[model samples]
Target: MPDNDSIDPTEVARPSSSRRDPEWLRARLDDWLPTVTGSPATITRLEIPSANGMSSETIVLDAAWEDTDHRLVVRVAPTPDSDPVFPTYDLDRQFRLIEHVASTTDVPLPTLYWSEPDPRPLGAPFFLMGRVDGVIPPDVMPYTFGSWLTEVSDDDRRTVAGTTIETLAMIHSAPVPEELLDLPGPGETPLRAHVRRLREFYAWASQGRAGSPLIERGFSWVDEHLPVESDPVLTWGDARIGNIIYQDLSPVAILDWEMAAHGPRELDVAWLIFLHRFFQDLAEMAGLPGLPEFLRRDDVADAYARSSGHEPRDLDFYITYAALIHAVVMYRIQSRAIHFGQAEEPVDTDDMILHRATLEAMLAGAYWAGVR
Candidate 1:
């Protein structure tokens, strides 16, 4: 089986289980590529990798069609058999959002080719896009944990962080096409929409077992300190440096819009800041040298403000929300681990929230001072 090289930064470090049946995929692409692309479609190289993305599966393939050879990527929705992390997998919405954002903003992204809703051909609804070559900052080992990103100069690191925030500003301030309203709009109250989605995810992730009391506390905090209403715009939900594909020291394409939404500007800003902090804290615990100064909360907020001309607000609330969102994701990862028989259920589920100390400090208002 051929494989596409990728980075899976899982906290638990599970064995690779993503499908890599290249012969099967070759046959499928051989037959299906022509319908979308023109005739003379030939699958030159196909790699159905099992090493990246714990949530959805990505297929990398090169095809020749109509006197042109092209490199492309296919994204498939998570199947029920895979214990998908998020409750929903809207590939069409993801495709449309990428298309919509690319047309209006300067943000770099893959070019779309086709979207398939039927599962009979590949056993999943998938979409195809031109492949953009770059490196993904690893989550498991972490770029801060001695990767190429960490090896770069401090000035280069700062540029990577700065441009990412600038690019995010580009996304937030761009006028979302009215045609996109036909697709998901992140609901009337985007923040509450996020909370409700989280609640649904919590119920699915619990899987008839007990839920996280700490998560409950996190939700309570969110309710108590909900930020004032402001103008909503299209937000890149998974806004973090790790999600950016970097060529040399600059970001080329910002991937992973699975969590994209229309929400307050600060939501994406806080997620970017807090996610870097998340990795930095992990490196500290592991006695590693994470990029502690690269994406500081204050720095990114200021960058967003300066770049987008919109005032950054409620950062404390949103960074804490970012932590909660990540905690929910970690719980889902643990649930998948259990479902895959990776580890036995532990007595204390609180231990599942690896950043319990960080969340507690945030809840107590002691965490922001240290990071800022």
Candidate 2:
């Protein structure tokens, strides 16, 4: 094994943007290969760039062994004292569920390699997976709307959008593993559970700071409009365009299953739409087609309905809930960044400002929509 005595867990850190390590992850691969294959392998390279403002450090690994080369991803858990977003996450369960979902449905995810559930070797729970090749669009859709419009023709963009909807449909269509997920017993609704969880999260955030009163109001709003509970689906905890890897304007692999759980179908759909705010830069905010012009809000929902055999007529309700969820997460992160000494003060700018002038617009929207 490599020299563990010299390795400092703090040294391998993630930036506020992309929290991934490109260095020394090979050491982890070296340690894991022996356990899986009964022989050590040579690691050539590892590269894990930080993702946009998301927690957790993700790295990529390239290894050579037995005269063959392999590419994979090593998702290292953040130090407990450093990233306190979610104290405990079941990465091994996540790995197994990904494999299960991949086998049962058409949802695309990275192939699995191994999962290190214990923190002994790497200092925290981490997992390795086959590296997928694709392009993740910049937060604001780096390509100009017109260029994105012209380069990938409208028809192709629609196909991609339709594919996204269909992929989600497949996920919603999959049968939930009753034994695996410790969901409440039959006839026991989960709305109260969701509410209790969110309340606890808000309480955690409000510990030493003045949290947005809007959160409590949002909770009330959700309580008032709770949908009639239906069968649960595999809710990709952080499902959004940014989490998807696209190839040739089409989604190829879905990433980030840490928060995967059995929840309302609208939760996934809401998150997918609310996270759209992250992709709107200034020009796009001013009506320029920031994303592919082919993806209308209705088109996605309609496609999902047609493919999943379920109609989502109350999309507005879900959208508002999505906005509230983003708002809560952003507020919590502001507190976390302050606690970590990364930011001098806590400020909620309605999903992190893309431009300076629209602070009021964003906040007002988040406050009313998220909390309403």
Clash count per candidate = 1, 3
**CA lDDT of each candidate?**
0.77, 0.62
Instruction: Kindly list the per-residue Cα lDDT of model 2 for residues 1-372, writing each as its tens digit.
Output: 011132121221222532433354556567877777566688887776655325677776787777778887777777775655664667777777887788888888888878888887777788888888876644432334343433676677777677777888877776786555546546656545655666777777677667675666667777777777656676776777667788876678888777676777877776675555433333244455455344445666777788888776556566666656655666666666656666545255332212222223333444223211
Best by TM-score: 1
In candidate 2 the C-alpha lDDT for residue 10 amounts to 23
TM-score against truth, every candidate: 0.92, 0.81
Runs in model 2 deviating more than 4 A are 1-24, 140-151, 185-188, 281-289, 292-294, 346-372
- Candidate 1 lDDT over residue span 245-291, tens digit each: 88876778888888887667788888988878877777766666677
lDDT of 1: 0.77
